[model samples]
Target: MSLPVHLAPSLTGVAPGETVEVTGDEAHHAVAVRRLRVGETVVLTDGAGTSVTGPVGSTGKRVFTVRVDDVRREPRPQPELVVVQALPKGDRGELAVEVLTEVGVALVVPWAAARSVAVWKGERAERSRAKWQATAREAAKQARRSWLPEVAALARTAEVVDLVAGADLALVLHEGADDALVHVDVPSAGRIVLVVGPEGGLSEAEVAALVGAGARSVRLGDEVLRTSTAGVVAAAAVLARTPRWG
Candidate 1:
């Protein structure tokens, strides 16, 4: 089995023969919950580009140390994918965040679309964003990714338009569109942004605004997918054509 991976603060200057400390909640989970022990090998990443592999050196109640034996710094993936995901109802938001991060999406933006049923207001807004971020963090570790995907703050339609306007290539999921996702040209550099609508689907105004901002309206196929799964499928399609997936 592959060694378990844990997130570290920063592995920027780390090298072989160094002892790196793991502390707080992360250590407690690995030690108490995962039953990590001395001499066991584990991988650690700063969730940026640096990662290391080492064996446990020591263990305390809420902390542990690892002897770094290998270090690697990965370059950022090409054609960075940023998905504008309209907030879904209930736990589906986290579900979307999870798969997006696992599939190597660079960023996930929670969009508040006009047709969205779930609303993020006041405390719930803060809490929902936290859930999405937490879900991404866990999913990155689970996928053993060298870089973690960022979950941006909740975005309004206007903000999303600005995002779309700035992308090298942008796409919006619309079942009614005549364009097929496979036919769209995927860029090999810069950002490729995709917008996944909510369960209620995108309003006509939303589609018009995004299209006006340079996003092409495209359909995956004849069968429509759930809001939670659409982003990942679209992301996978985009990645497939890029060197990142080659």
Candidate 2:
């Protein structure tokens, strides 16, 4: 199959039977790089499975027009995957966010665990949060998702615990735990949260604290995983077990 065409905010809000004006970065790529021209048909997807087959109109340096030919609505993924990952040192945290978004996680929460090397406090916290959000947005666009995943502010351990407390099923991935992720059966709840600890792993006290906050301790497997990889793996497991994932 050909690469699914992407539409930006410029073409957003253009409904069926409406003409859309595309501009800026997307337009530049489409016109200059892709060389999409007038009369060419392309499959435009909003990234949420909502797609429109439209013929290119006037292609320009920074703008183009595409008349909507068809529209199809795709519902959002059920059992939304929310990953609560402890901020790892250096760029690993950012990589974690990027991969989780690509895996179709619905939300990414940066948690500051006891062993977390990266601290997102003060102005740094705001900037880091913005970066994570931007990463999610870019990943979502690449994945052609109509709905964007939410990047939450940097949260402390307590705050992270509180956030997942209300989820339909909240699980904390840890090593040496007896409960296997695949063995555990979950109900058809539409909202599940997975918590990942830092590189050094969640401290004993921290694990107790999380358990107190209503998160169940679950084991991924025998081998240990880095903070960056744990979230994605756990998310995949949860999504696979969920009904909608099938």
What's the TM-score of every candidate structure?
A: 0.99, 0.86
Candidate 2: misplaced stretches above 4 Å? 10-14, 25-36, 43-50
Candidate 1: list runs displaced more than 4 Å. none
Q: RMSD of candidate 1 to the true fold?
A: 0.7
Q: Write the per-residue lDDT of candidate 1 for residues 208-239, one digit (tens) a residue.
A: 99999999999999999999999999999999
Query: lDDT: which candidate is best?
Result: 1
RMSD of 2: 2.6
- By summed lDDT, the worst window of 10 consecutive residues in model 2 runs over 3-12
* lDDT of candidates 1 onward, in order: 0.94, 0.81
Instruction: Give the root-mean-square deviation of each candidate in angstroms.
Output: 0.7, 2.6
TM-score of 2: 0.86
